[model samples]
Target: MSETTSKYKAPALERGLDILELLSEQDEAISKKDMVAKLGRSVNELYRMLAILEARGYITTEPESGKYRLTLKMFELSNKFPPMQRLLNAAGTEMAKLSEKTQQSCHLSVLHDAEMVVIAVQDSPYKMGFCIRLSARIDVHGSGSGFAMLAFQPEDQRRAILEASETPEPVIESVLSQMDKVRQKGYFIGASPQISGVTNISYPIFNSNRQVEAVLTMPFLTLNSDSLHHQVVSFEESRLAVADAADNLIHAIGGCTPE
Candidate 1:
């Protein structure tokens, strides 16, 4: 059949994007009827669009409820692009400067496998702070970096991550108890449980999709002798710096960017 005469010649491209955009805006899953009503498309057309989106891994539907929501494809697509590299490149020099300024170790982390994984780090010249390893997996309930990232996650996803953390049950309960404290303070501050005399300062990084995609962590300890015992650095300054840098990076990579 001629392209213009074919019933299957619907605007597949537009419909697919529409589905993604619509799902992203919704805080909860939406029904097919609601989707068709909002998209102003016929039932058949919406069904076809939803099918294509699901097959492409861009959207998901409840097996029993038939409700739809956005999938992790958004994160996968963001990672597939080179823009994250650009963020690192743009901020690498600045990160060094920050470490030098504060005389403290600095690190960057991104959410992966529902855990906060360190992707970059700049150690302090003083050697007093914990040295973070690249690709280290941190518990969402324990580390300062993990708490910073988890604080910004969607409620359901956050709960799931915490539930699945490998941390001991008692520690998990204590961390959960302090979540409100973390949120109210806009930071997680405490002595390092894994390392003595180490302080952790961390903040989340937002992506173009406005999802908390990563975190920047700083570890430092006072160089002064008997500086009031173990003192972890506060996150106030580092959070602002990471937030600004992340905003710039997101704007740069709003769409895919070349190396």
Candidate 2:
């Protein structure tokens, strides 16, 4: 907690938020007993907070297990926020077009603190395609989309993110070198370090002030030769399509590339 946050205290609100945060990190529903243990709070104190959250539809109870889990309410609320809404509106059509043109899934990500978060994604039109889930958090120094966004940031901001990274020093140095190349090439195209047989193509989307606003990424997957759709999009084609989609989204959002 920051000094400013500590200065102004709201015990009830903090408890509620803590519960929400805990639930968000959990992959399975948690019982009230588990929540109490995890939060280190007494059952008496959490009962009301849980009831309020459940009543407000921010959380729901699993009928059979009688455990609590988060609902989609928070995600829905985030999409209604103005800036995110604008970004989504601008990128939605272009992302769809990119997928249709490249026959590969595409996603839009923005930097949030030291990490990148997928805010929007468009699945490929084909039955077999690579798709990243919305709201997935990605390592800032470990992805093509991360490099694309970081390559264009103001030097001080980039340095700050690098300083906060937990990656090994040697890996961070390599990523820095890769970011320089991304700046020179105006995009990134490489095999994914996390997955086999997948190529990542990414472009930085800039705002009107020529600041990177987001990264548009296509995880290109080569389809099997025996598949019904034998037409394979070449690497060059996917790169061009992704670049064009990034350009279109920037235009739609009234953004401009650095001169």
Candidate 3:
């Protein structure tokens, strides 16, 4: 409540923040000498700030080269806020429930920089199943979640994503027909041509604008298909489970279904 405390500032904290901001703008690490040149500060001035940041696990220094770059701590912290945090909380719960019931590995994906990035993954309840790593990027045309998202998006936006990739993402008649089917059926169920014995089932999660906000996918697999313990889940069963999960997720986050 004191007037002086409200206006008080820490110059050291400000300098450390400046370094973090600068490092974030770079695609690669920055050397101490280069950092000084870019920051227009003496080495001594920034040395302590760098030391503290590194010690606190905010920035990391390369062993081979004395260059420094930011760590994932900031990104992890940021995911605790808006849209993404809200999404994770809701999707995690739904994905867990889906996986438990279906005994199938599932993941939540979002379109990032023209690619589908897996944000969260839930393992199958079975002893043997596959789980995708967090932050893995998948091809827009080749992945179930990727294709599912693109199928629901506006045509122009989809076109832009395809055009932006240097390697031409193949557009085939079958894929086109499948997209039409996905839109019509409200879900996608198909075998992944790239991965044998793995079926990809995807559902679109909507936002307040009734636009496709994310894709919820189950990379279905049979562990010991011949084993009498596991019962085969039908395509219709998978579709309904994923669809219900998406709907429950929408309610959790106060979102809408696509129009």
Q: What does each candidate score in C-alpha RMSD?
A: 15.1, 2.7, 8.6
Candidate that scores best on lDDT: 2
For residues 1-259, what per-residue lDDT tens digits would candidate 2 score against the true structure? 1122467888888888988999999999999999999888999999999999999999999999999999999988988987667889988888888888877899999998688999999999988888899889999888888889889986676767866767777777777776667898999888888989898999998888898889999988977766664878788888988888888888877888998
> Which residue runs does candidate 2 get wrong by more than 4 Å?
1-9, 62-66, 224-229
Report the C-alpha lDDT of model 3 over 36-94, residue by residue, as the tens digit. 88877888989999999999999999999989999999988979778778889888788
Candidate 1, clashing residue pairs? 199-232
Top candidate (TM-score):
2
Model 2 Cα displacement at 200 (Å)?
0.9
Instruction: Give TM per candidate.
Output: 0.56, 0.88, 0.73
Report the C-alpha lDDT of model 1 over 1-259, residue by residue, as the tens digit: 1123455655876777777877877889999999889888889877787887889888888898989999888866665667577667655776677776666777888777667777787787655555777667787676888887776665676667777766676776676666767666655667777878777766555665666656677765546646646543345555465445545545554622111
Q: After superposition, how far is residue 140 of candidate 1 from its true place, in Å?
A: 2.4
Q: At residue 162, what lDDT does model 1 achieve?
A: 73
Arranged by lDDT with the best first, the candidates are 2, 3, 1
